[model samples]
Target: MNVAPVTPPRPLDVAAVFPQLVPLARTATRLHPRPGAPTWYDSSIGGPLLWPADEPWPHCEGPHEVDGMNPVLSPADVRLERRIRAASHGREMTPQEQKTLERIRPPRKLPMRPAVQPYDGSMAMLPVAQLYARDVPDLRAPKGTDLLQVLWCPFDHPIMPRTALFWRSAATVTDILGTPPEPPAMQFDAYLPEPCLLHPEQITEYPDHLELSTELQEQLSQWSVPQADEEDMDPQTYYDCVLSNAPGWKVGGWAAWDSTDPCPRPCPECGTGMEVLLTIATFEEGDDEGRSWSPYENPAAEPSPGSDHFDPGRPTAVQIGRGHRQHLYICPAAPEHPHLELMT
Candidate 1:
């Protein structure tokens, strides 16, 4: 079913070269999400959650500001558009398909639904991910919890969509929700994720060199990749891109804070430090993103450039601000404490 290898291939034994990095190793679950029709019981991205039917669906009470860039469209419209695009790829659309397209996106008008009022109303949240602890070995859930459900408002709260976290006992959810509520209209179509099944692979990760101690950072700068081609790259740059925090969808690993690498995200309620719970990323890695970071066992299976097919790199099709990452941090002191969201 396209599950990724647990031990992803790496060019160099990083820890062998950098002995000091051994103790810094932290296990992270790489959720290699590939497009599939996932059911409620499956651990998936943009899939149905194993939610109790009686529980009220979460909604975002927002004062949403619509930038001209976002053209509001209903979830149904988005799905239809996707289907039309896929069906017509590399071929001319049938007359009926063209008519259906026009019905969804009529000339000189925007797609909208009468019931949507996100400008000053509560909008039902869309499922971002649903992870069962059994599927993700690195999922550090609360004592009574075995499932983690993530949902997000389709409208941008600041620059990125706001997300909510829910932890529950899978056994307690006796009756599954037949159909959860969807927002009448969403600001951006990218907010609607393509359903993807997870191939959770546990891997070790170290903090970004920028997030390391000054001494460790200094030490790293002196060690470049032994490879002939990468020898030209700076030592720290190689480590940061190839050996440090992995990219794409993952749980409980170092966050790629890039320019905003303060790294000390303390809990708002308690003084205890926060930990990264999830990272919703735009693109999965390829050879271009460094061989070490990519989870693909076969290089040829990677998405080819200029192809009119589904790009595996963007299987979920969820993009944060300007193609950045949306990281959710939970309080280490108490999982129930309000989670924090950051875009980087």
Candidate 2:
């Protein structure tokens, strides 16, 4: 009797794999901290709520859990907590304690994502992805191969909605596979406003044709089978294309109205053309969709429901008047205060 021989599974490429592992160790920031007041980071549900160590956080009940890791902190989360506790007790942390605290504390990042470009005629809930290059030594990677891909998830940004943190394919994956004969995009109809746990295997494929741009068309045209230098390509462009066709604003917080004459143009960061997810006219509709509404909507409308007077001191929403493209941008300089205008 002939027996089939079992081949050993390929060895874990330790040298090639360690480079990717470093990213997991980088401390992740809580975009919506439990103890902070409301901001765009709280765009999801009832807005940001205080998460005091003395009390429990509000829990969501459903088929999938929205509440984060149980108790006050995970093992990894404890290091940062201890540091703050020690400081509050009026004691200096030891050198070892300091190092561990740094490893667990969130890194400082610029406020992005919510950036608006009136000139580009677009509004973005968040910067889709920020790319950084790192070096890796691979046993199989040719001696000259050095750069590796480091793509950040959009929901990781504090200002973006928790629901927006869906899985996105790596740009390098496409570079290696080449553009599929039929590239797919996520179905707009499939996205849910609420957050849910998703498994890696459950990822969906979307078509590449929903919203197209001339630059994107040119890039897609140039993709040939088995191409080199695929690692450096920008895959976010493909996402921007798909989002351009999204049925409606997925999250609601702030809306911009450009001073241009005719209509608000789509944001270059978000829309293919001049994309306005909401106008002053639609601010009320967005407020109805989520807890946030524009202060400009009813200058007389209360900041929070049931308040006696509107916080006229709060920033105004960008008015989308008739225009080709406003040169203004969502002010990155003032994340807490985002309004429509130029990129400057």
Candidate 3:
């Protein structure tokens, strides 16, 4: 895929507006992943990784709850349903038409047991995403590691899917695993991420309003006090454009603490502080303010529903509770140490 450089929106000079905030500016890289089938060499979601064939594949052993009524339909069945809906085009369905469609495409019946049964005596893990430092410039791996592979069980574990992170050197994997096992059924379509190629664009970012101190926040809200050439400029609009954090899937940006306060995440192996490595966001922007982070080129093009560009926020189609975000944290001191996940 031809990756174009992002054309960032022209933001108000906040530092010029308020000199006190000059030191708060930070750079972040947005990994804009579009739908595609990526190879082992490409940085992508639901793509193959450079895994050694000798190593054991990761799997989750769980007693997951089964939804017997909700069945996993085959790809063919899904396509047929789509064709039927398209043909109908919202027109009322006649009894004969409905009966014929029902007979051809019956309601799906999902398995009563978990997607992958524990003690099945096999490594039944499914690949989620794979990233190479060469492809994703913002990936922070250990000195010897350049590859990051993420996998998870198809079934949910409590509130979210159970995930595992593996960091390795691409050169060390001489014997690669050509094929891997997949779960019999996935609980949700969102869980199945479509393959997407990354177009990493570096941009400036700032702390979310929630991260700022009460006093500093109050100072920002008092836009009326500041003398400006544009009398129509709203203080709140300026704050949203220049002061707030840019949204979307990014690296090395401040956490979005809109729902809750910042909770200190410490490494389990070492008590050292863990930093945010990657943010798996549901939508590129939660609100209008997030539009500041939209790609520079064609920023105003609105994608229609069901189009490839539809749901600009969820390019990867990976959702965590109605379009919330999942933050992946790694130990700064020991990059190889186990990572942690927080869904917010």
Query: TM-score per candidate, in order?
Result: 0.88, 0.17, 0.77
RMSD (Cα, Å) for all candidates, in order, is 4.2, 25.2, 5.6
lDDT of 3 by residue, 1-344 (tens): 33353836644666676666668776767777665567878887766777899998786676554454455533234334544554566598767668756865466665444554433322356677787888666677788989988887655666667788899999999998898666655655566665566777776666765567788788777863352224345555456544456666777666776456677789999989887777777776535443545665533244323423234556676777677777788898997788887776
| Native-to-model Cα distance after best TM-score fit, residue 76 in candidate 1, in Å | 0.8
Residue-wise lDDT of candidate 1 within 86-141, one digit each (tens)?
86877999999999888876665454444434376789999999999999987888
Report, for every candidate in turn, its global Cα lDDT versus the true structure: 0.79, 0.23, 0.66
Name the candidate that leads on lDDT. 1
lDDT of 2 by residue, 1-344 (tens): 31211212211222132232222221111111011123222222122211223322222121121112211123224424433553544577778766665655445455532332112111122111111112111101112422211111112112212121111222322223221111011111111111111000111112222223466445544542112133232343322222111111111112221231234434445443321111112012211222221111232332333221122221111111221111222222221122333210
Model 1's alpha-carbon lDDT is: 0.79
Q: What residue pairs clash in candidate 1, if any at all?
A: none
Q: Model 1, 326: alpha-carbon shift in Å?
A: 0.9
Q: Any runs in candidate 2 off by more than 4 Å, and if so which?
A: 1-36, 39-47, 50-96, 99-249, 252-344
Q: Could you tell me the TM-score of candidate 3?
A: 0.77
Please identify model 1 stretches exceeding 4 Å from their true place: 1-7, 102-118, 225-236, 286-289, 298-309
**Number of clashes recorded per candidate:** 0, 43, 4
TM-score of 2: 0.17
